[model samples]
Target: MRPDYPLKTDRLVLRPFEEHDLDDLHAYRSDPEVCRYLYTHCATLEDSADRLTKTLTMSELTEEGQWLVLAAYLPEAGRVIGDVVLKWISEKHRQGEIGYVFNPEFQGRGLAREAAEEMLRIGFEDMKLHRIEAQCDPRNEPSWGLMERLGMRREAHFRQNEVFKGEWGDLYIYAMLDEEYARAS
Candidate 1:
């Protein structure tokens, strides 16, 4: 199993989803700007609640492909500003996947990266993952750039391989192996 939640970075607290986080979570998940690269369109309040409800049951995943979603809490702001997700993709392969979303209001800040770096530490050091990968829309520069900043290499760029939000979208995959992470650390 992975480490317990509330994983902290210098300026952010990454905690498991809670019953009361609906409003703060919805604020960003519902924003077109924030959901641009996400599979679903902007969320409704009910959609946010349903999403959070699913995450609440996912503090840890004993099975492959199960995901754990954590809220990115900003203490100074006293509210949730985003979320990070880590999926146990293949225990046999010791592989996992990571994803994230943040309010546009918080985009310029490095809070998302701060939270994501901690997730990497947990997946690599605590969970003993051999590799962690990430996929993002190629047009989402901020998203893929953040992955690069985390020391992951651009492993692939599939051309217009899938439709997202009713439109054709390209994809970029970034990944880092455990040995690479160890050397970087």
Candidate 2:
């Protein structure tokens, strides 16, 4: 589904990534700490530019395997602080997934949660999804903590699931169903 642009929360704007967001996208994506748990390593400016170019095409989700990625823009800061993503994983099963990454400068402010919650809303309310889930490295406390705060129950913990950063890594999966979302709302 193509979301109405500029999905607004109390303190941030969730919109599609743009050509102009390169610098801001690089700001956080270039940080080693931010990229530690992510699949990609710290990105160079050119890398961020390449990523932004691809992100430009991910603004809408019209079919399975597509991703809808939005920029988490803080107007007062006059820049994009992070991004939120929803993947249309399975249309027949009505399943989707949510994910996010924000500048450390913007952490501890609930902005990531605010942006991610909107993705959940779009998944369950707008897209009529049956289930939505999020997965993160088990050691990423802040990420899992935010999932708990959003009322997503811990669904699984896979030990040494894959090679990450050249070592085995554990994964934590959290999820919420449409009925669960209705109750939480």
Summarize candidate 2's per-residue lDDT along 38-145 as a digit string, tens digits.
Answer: 999999999999999999989888899999999999999999999999999999999999999999998999999999999999999999999999999998999999
Model 1 off-target regions past 4 Å?
none
Please give, for residues 1-185, the per-residue lDDT of candidate 1 as tens digits: 74665677898888888999999999998999888788988899999999999898877767888997888999999999999888889999999998899988988788888988887887898788999999999999999999999999999999989877788889999999999999988
Could you tell me which residue pairs clash in candidate 2? none
Supply every candidate's count of residue pairs whose N, Cα or C atoms clash at under 3 angstroms. Answer: 0, 0
lDDT of 2 at 48: 98
TM-score of each: 0.96, 0.99
Residue 33 in model 2: shift from native, Å?
1.0
RMSD of 2: 0.6
What are the runs in model 2 whose C-alpha is more than 4 Å off? none
Top-scoring candidate (TM-score)? 2
